[model samples]
Target: MARPLRFRRSPERWTASRVHDQLFTDLDDNLGATAVDPTFRPAGEWETRRFEMDNDDVALFIWDDDAAYWMGNTETPSALWRTDKYDWGEVPYQVARWAQRELLADLHEESPWLEPYPHVSWFFLPVFMSKDGRHTTREFFRDHAAGFPDAGRDEGLGFYEEFLSTGVLDEYRDEMSGKLGTSPQFDLVRMSSAMAEFTAAKLLTDAGYQVTPEIEVTTGHSLDFRAAKGNHQPLVEVTRPLPPTQRAADTAVAAVRETAETKTSGQLSEHGGGAVLFVDCSSFHDDQWRAVRGEQPEVRHRPAVVYRVRPNGHAEGYTKGAVPLDLDGAIEWV
Candidate 1:
């Protein structure tokens, strides 16, 4: 793992000979990268060139004599001194748009399975091609079923594809996708934990409530989500219990209780109230969830929900206290 897909600005000013020297002499010889024409060029004053490697890695260089920018999924050229990285928003809007289009085309061509799920791919392209998170992130969906148990990659990808296709949470794409983490190592628990936010977002959106994530409260803490419809606005904090095998908790219910308790006692405790606690047991097996569902144990917070969701779009749960949101449509009350 390297780093997130971002603008690696060149320290030295661009010249045609240096650009050619780097691409042909260094990248071509060592990295096997060859210059290729991009499908759609950005309409701008800056000169742009595209390079691709045999392994399907693509890099784009947008430069004028004044400055140069490098972006892609490969090892950045060693000759070009890369300094500060730029998030998508930090660069010129046209450059970001052009890079996204060019890379997305190459992305779909290499992994056709993802083409049908444009929204999901487009939303996560930053991390999906990130230097550190790329392989592991793609593997999560392509191999690990995107964190679903007892399911294959297609089911998991399709489940998210449908939800993301609705565009309900598209406005939050940049920050939300970054939550998946662009660290250099594969940490399933950490990555899966980030996805719990998406699962919660789907739940809130499916329930017809507008969902906004990372709501900072007066307590100087940021809650997971805010669900609103009309004048009704409720803060939501989501927690996920590891499956029985993954945690030391003796049982699934205990796992749920313990995880939720950790959350409630931390930020929610400081916030003092009016938040809904959503206990996501999606990682639990069928048997594990059934046992937890049998007893809606207290999670040290009222107005809390204990729930599990399946890839087929079915969810069931029980509420501990008077939940502010009417979730009958989104969850099957047990």
Candidate 2:
């Protein structure tokens, strides 16, 4: 069974008025009065200003024609422009989003820009805060700057600052949005096992084999991967050894052998080409691998080749029955 996906709500919510006030507050605090143009823009004309937020230089743009605000880092001037257009009324939300993304970046977190929603705050701040008693933006304001004129600015800055300092943003994102997180469509253990299989598929790709992961077969079981070159297309099943216990090793080997026999001897019977069982033995030692490999099981129909991959990415092939082709050379080819 897989874990249920969890949804989180942002601790601080921002409205248009909140964003407007915060931007101006940031402008006043960082760049002083000269940076902001007191003169109003003519209809259809736009104005831009450079300011600082938490010591980082930022750019603020106001489009009078559309009544929108665009703010981003001055260094990557166009980076924030790619975000969805924010009406002047939505400037606060836009700034809040930008601050969150920037803070995640500073923390070395992978924060992809998801579609923004109105009235709903999506920033997950607590996940990014340290377990230690480090002051988050929220905490700073609550503790030291409680009397600040603009509470929204402090809250927004605190959320982002805490995110940068804590560094759990990635984990939070994964748990909330990653494949194995909240989705009920996939089993967690199955997804993890598939990842290992995909690793083998990646190796096949690196070896110049055109490989596809998770190819469905008639037997209702999907082949882990399928690799092709010219007219040769071989079904590949990837297996990783179980725990070091003898019973676990025996069970894993039997499962692999049974799968190979059933698939190749049944739906794949008409095709002369055999299937490959790629075993990832990275977790195993020589003795463990030898025990896991065990005595070669008998195959009734098409020849099967068992390939063991080492931790350092080397592979050794073992053949069962009279395999006419050079399976080892074929695997290592290219």
Candidate 3:
């Protein structure tokens, strides 16, 4: 019996020569004579292989010292190229199949005669398989825990585990499917933000507050979460701070405030108070923190608090006006 392959971290050293050798070797075994006009060009650090479907060419490129591949025809190429860094230890044969599937799926949109493989969302790929070939949440959790031990105890991981185990995640998946039909790619950024909101909800629930997720307002803006205990009902907006590469400090801060105002405007009418929970993914400077802290008073939305939660789970900030809640003890700083 063949040993079950497990997901592992990428090796520290990945040279072009190693990738070239491994990729071609795997292709020889999987494709045989079916792979047409395959060629390797060392000068450009790329390789190309023609497939039977529409005689389309799929090319692999070395990007930032990582193996990345894209599939398309001679006239137009795929906008997005899938990378091998995400699943470094995955068999090259399987990688080829994935790229082929993606290419065929794209081509099928234009030419109905081109047969496409059964669609599989990128999020739930080969990662969810068990030793017995069964796919289960338990197996996914085990793989996740093994592959990413650092995030094993994270609140996001915990929330996902709970949701998967209790079937809430399936419902959420169905809701998303209803909103947006099936697609080949997954919006990882949006998913991460949702997970962050879920983490905040869990934290509030643990603190004895009844928490609600994704509350839509009459103003067409959505609050990430709402937590209520007794008469202290606070509308909470959870946001993952954008990296400096994506948005400048001034622009990011402005955007944050704008988002807060939209939510505050709607909730202030019904709720006792409002707060903004900024999940600090970006490495924020002292000036940025000061700017965020200073913005509280200017915010016309009174009785509002701003909390900046760090990657390590430590959080700090201030509350303005006469909010009945205590910021220090109410929130778990670490």
Candidate 4:
């Protein structure tokens, strides 16, 4: 899988001739790239050139008297040394904005079908147009229906587009979106697990809590989320069970219990309590989910929510012990 775009620093000093021999030669031979105008004036001493290639590949080269940086989706030159990878927001403002605009234009141009969902396009730009994760990530929503066994591509995309448009998790975009991964090949189980976080995030916000993700604790581990409502804050750890057919568990009920038990015994146990567990059964189809929901079996953890959600905006579940957040509005108590 290809990595997200980051700056690669070159030790060798740049000359106009050197840019052609060392940089342009590699990209042109590899991707048939051409140096073109970026249209925007750079903010500093760096002279910038944008290279656009066939098959949706691009790389931006920026250099000044002291240093040269390469940021793009193509093969990096061997001469350039990789620098520390910063989050998308941590990159320089001008460079980040420039890369975003260029990549977004390519995204819309290539996948015109995604143009309607502006929020989804913009929010997932980092991953949707990432070097190699682009096709696999986009296909997860388009073909897999975002892990809904019974939902169509549109239903799944629209469901997530709505939640993302709320901008509740926008601040944590890098961490949250990267969870979907950038594998070159398609993977259903892995991609679905990533969407589970999105589902969990929606539940947290809809239940009226200001949510922060990847919360660090004294145990030297990070909890999935921290849900804050008024003065109350509850740590939340979310997990999703494999459908009965995919796992060793014989029944859907058993699948729920078995999967939940794994989380309860691991991180939650290590934290020594004070966190709520969320077991999401969104991957279950109607009949499979009905079995789990009917029984509402114990997940072996206190203050836990066992729920199944549909792409059509319906969610129902049962809770154990006393749940800290007010989830009554979003989750129909069963």
Q: Which residue pairs does candidate 1 place in steric collision?
A: 1-132, 2-131, 2-132, 3-132
Clashing pairs in 3: none
Which number leads on TM-score?
4
By how many angstroms RMSD does model 4 differ from the true structure?
Answer: 2.5
lDDT of each: 0.83, 0.41, 0.41, 0.84
lDDT of 1 by residue, 1-334 (tens): 4656788776567776777897646678777878867788886787888888876677888876567788977776676554678888777877888899987886687677888888889989988877677767877778778888999888888888888889887777778888888876777787778888888889888899999888999989999998999999999998888987898998988898889889988888999999999889998888998898888788999889889998888999999879999888989989
Per-residue alpha-carbon lDDT of model 4 for 81-180, expressed as tens digits?
Answer: 4554566676566666766776777788888878888888888887887898989988987788989998898888888899999999989887788888
Model 2 stretches astray by more than 4 angstroms: 1-192, 218-221, 244-275, 292-294, 298-303, 321-334
lDDT comparing candidate 1 with the true structure:
0.83
Any runs in candidate 4 off by more than 4 Å, and if so which? 7-18, 29-32, 38-47, 53-56, 63-69
Q: Count the backbone clashes (under 3 Å) in each candidate.
A: 4, 4, 0, 0
For residues 1-334, write the lDDT of model 3, one tens digit per residue.
Answer: 1111122223234544654455434444444313345342233433444433233323332322444443222211222222222332243544444443444444344333212212222123222121222232223223333112234424323433543443332323322222221222343334344345544554465457776556776656666666778887776765555433345434546645655555556655455444544343323444565566565333445555555544344556565566545455545432
Single out the weakest 10-residue window by summed lDDT for candidate 4: 77-86
Looking at candidate 3, the ten consecutive residues that score lowest on lDDT are 1-10
Model 3 bad stretches (over 4 Å): 1-189, 215-223, 248-255, 258-300, 324-327, 330-334
Q: What is the TM-score of each candidate against the true structure?
A: 0.87, 0.39, 0.39, 0.90
